[model samples]
Target: MKKKMMVGGLLPALVLSTCGLAGAQPVAMDTLTAMEQNPDAGSQMRASTEPVTQESLQEMRRQLEEQLQQAQELQNRLNAQLGSLEKRMKKVEKKSWEPPVEIHGYGRLRWDKHRYEDRNDPNDYKTIWLNLFTKYRINDRWALHSEHEFENNLTTNHGAYEGQGGYNEPGGKKYSRPVLQLYAEGRVGEVNVKAGRYYLQSPYKFTFDDKIDGWQISYGIPTKWGRKANFTLSAGNTYSKIFYGDKENESNYWNEGGDGNLKVVSLIGEIPVAKNTNLAMHYGKIKRRNDRLERKTWSIGFDTKINRDLKFWAGIAKSDSQTLNKSHFLQLQYKEARPDIPGSYDIYIKKYLQRGHSGMTNWFNDDIAEFTHGDYKEENIANNGNDKVFQYSRWGEFNGLRIGVDFVPTRNTKLLINYTFGKMGKCLDKDPGRRYDYSFFRTQWEMYF
Candidate 1:
């Protein structure tokens, strides 16, 4: 009887141990002692007890070993997963500390046909331009940008006036070498600043295509109406031969001109006058070192959006010079060409009445104001000149109409076609007979990366 009781107790203890190993509640030591000391407790368990054998004990031991092995395998897998997650987190932290850089630009191919009333044959030429732009972000508050341009003329003969004297070469003008265009730009608080070689767009003093060597500062004005307003000041020397002098001269540097050092200062302001409309004003002063000729220029204009897809702009510019002192323009545009959207297009019409002195440099669209050397002549009224006939070459007087269409066939690709027809004459010429009729046509294709 004693042996049977002992086996019964041992069997219960083994069952409890197995349950504990399988993550169940463990039997307390006091409960085990009570079961052993109390006769009633023994009697309660006696009916449920079974005979204990060596085979049964071996089977329980084997099950416990297998459970322990599974738990160890699970712990190993969890440890490996944690290690992989830690590695990915370290990689993300490294990337957050590095600076960012970007590179992009565009290439253009253009064909031009120019016809003057006095010339017997039209001049046709083709040009190719490649521009490279780079940007580096030093931090959230500061960054740097640079642009380089390469221009090449593909037409060798250049039509009838092939050997005529011109700016770069007698046969044809070409810029085969790369030239640095824009250098740096940054922002400080509410002010934006630019340095090195850059371009400006103003009514009288500068156009969008004119390159200048200098610096610029601009600030935005806060308004209660949530309208846009800004003030800009720029001072620089002309860096291209297109600015008021011999077109053939290699004056692609600072303060380089045919006459002497040429410098310019310009101030511009835009104030919101109405919904989707703004009043624009500009003041510019240009001075030449050798001749001491100082020209003061100013303009007032307004631009407005007639509707969602239509816009209009008109402005008048005046100069203090005796000749070429007045100019005005009106423009209307329908739709807009978006480079990122395929099948996008725009159409525009512009009317211009410009005097030579009114624009210190050529207009942004060269086809609108085509200037030919020795084509228009005026009597020397200044009296300081040695020649009796003053040959006007740069931005000579012209009144014209220009119409253009810009289309995008695919993303980052654009096609442009424009035509200009007008009458051009000597600067400040009052005689209507001296004016000659002219026409210009141009087509351009561009691709961006």
Candidate 2:
């Protein structure tokens, strides 16, 4: 019986292999038929008992296809993530304040009192002064600025007696307070271009501090000393003959109608000298600007700082003068404005000379000119129709010296005191003249923010 059962189980496997009817794995069909007759067959069923049907095969194929699709989707997601990470790693960043705008201004207020020695004249007087300025920076290379000045007690009552009615008070008219500067500037390449009415503080600050009406071009190279070596070429109106101390007190050079002779040219330079110091040089020319003044002016000057607290300035210039005659000026200054100190101070001394037709040009200089014709020397200080002192505003054949000090109790406040002494020339007429000795005292107070 055992031999017959073994033969019976082997017959179907051999027949299936011969016919090649099974797919991957051959099934024992004869043995399976024999098992159906046994009572224990149900307990020996395999995990995959049925032969593979078309429906089952299709289901298996569908499952494989889904798994392949899922793997492909996962691979594509990894590739996208890698690309995004590479982009983030390769990118850069930038800054915020590429272009900019700004604003700033400074101003001052002052009082002055002056008198003359050895002259029995009504020359002692009181005065007040004020000025304001504004600046606007439009861009990195462009800017604009404006300045205005107001004054009182600029006129004097020369003809009136004590307690009598005369011209004594200030001419406080709207037009009297003139704009000292109004300008616009921009940089193109290495050169800066500026246009409009502006103040001219030439080398030495000795020859002039007048308002100029026109344009300028400048260039500069920076140095180790913090100051720049710069060059400036400018053209504008200069030196208009008028009395700033008289009733008309004319100072405007721009809108007074064009004078063919009013135009002038200037070349100026600032060169580095030492740490916290610089050297300044200037050359300027003024053409004949009026019917009464058919002449020209050419000037030269230099200024330098010796240390952080010491400086010197000087100039020798000629204007409608005799041969070998020239105008001369010299100044020495000491200053200390420390960042850690609230109290700062400056002391300065100056000598001046205006002879041989140097002319009266620097009207808006640091000091005021004499107002009366009777008190002025031949080189007038206030040149109205009356032979006055505009010519001698700074100096003349007469010896002149001035000393001043500026005291600061805080960052925004200052006090100034100045004294001037002058001696008259020997050749001056005796009629409207007082004496050879002249002197005065002036004081000013200023505040700014």
**In terms of TM-score, which candidate is strongest?**
1
**Poorly placed runs, candidate 1 (over 4 Å):** 1-99, 157-177, 203-209, 240-260, 363-365, 369-395, 428-433
Question: Lowest summed-lDDT stretch of 10 residues in model 1?
Answer: 248-257
Best by lDDT: 1
The whole-model lDDT of each prediction reads 0.67, 0.56
**What TM-score goes with each of the models?**
0.67, 0.58
Per-residue lDDT over 1-449 for candidate 1, one digit per residue giving the tens place of the 0 to 100 score: 77667766775676556545535323333343454456355554455555334565456555645655675677699999999999888767646864367889999999988888877888787878788888787666666777787665676533222223344563222322244565577788889988877777784233323667789999988775587589989888863333334232234311222342668788889888887888888887766655555667788998899999999999888777554567788999999999999999999998988665566555324545432332333456555765476544333567889999999999999999999989876434333236778788999999999
* lDDT of each residue in 1-449, candidate 2, tens digit only: 56445545553455445344323222433443444455355443322243334464355445544544565677699999999987765542111332133333444444454544544763555545556677676765888888876544534422212111233333111122167788998999999999998877676554445678899999999888877799999888753442222212224322222233466677888887777555666666655444333334455656677777888877776654332135677889999544235688889998886442343345324554443222233343454656554332222343578899888887777777898777533222222133357666777666665
Off by over 4 Å in 2: 1-109, 154-177, 223-226, 242-261, 273-277, 289-308, 323-325, 337-341, 355-360, 363-365, 371-398, 425-435
Q: Judge candidate 1 against the unseen true structure and give its global Cα lDDT, from 0 to 1.
A: 0.67
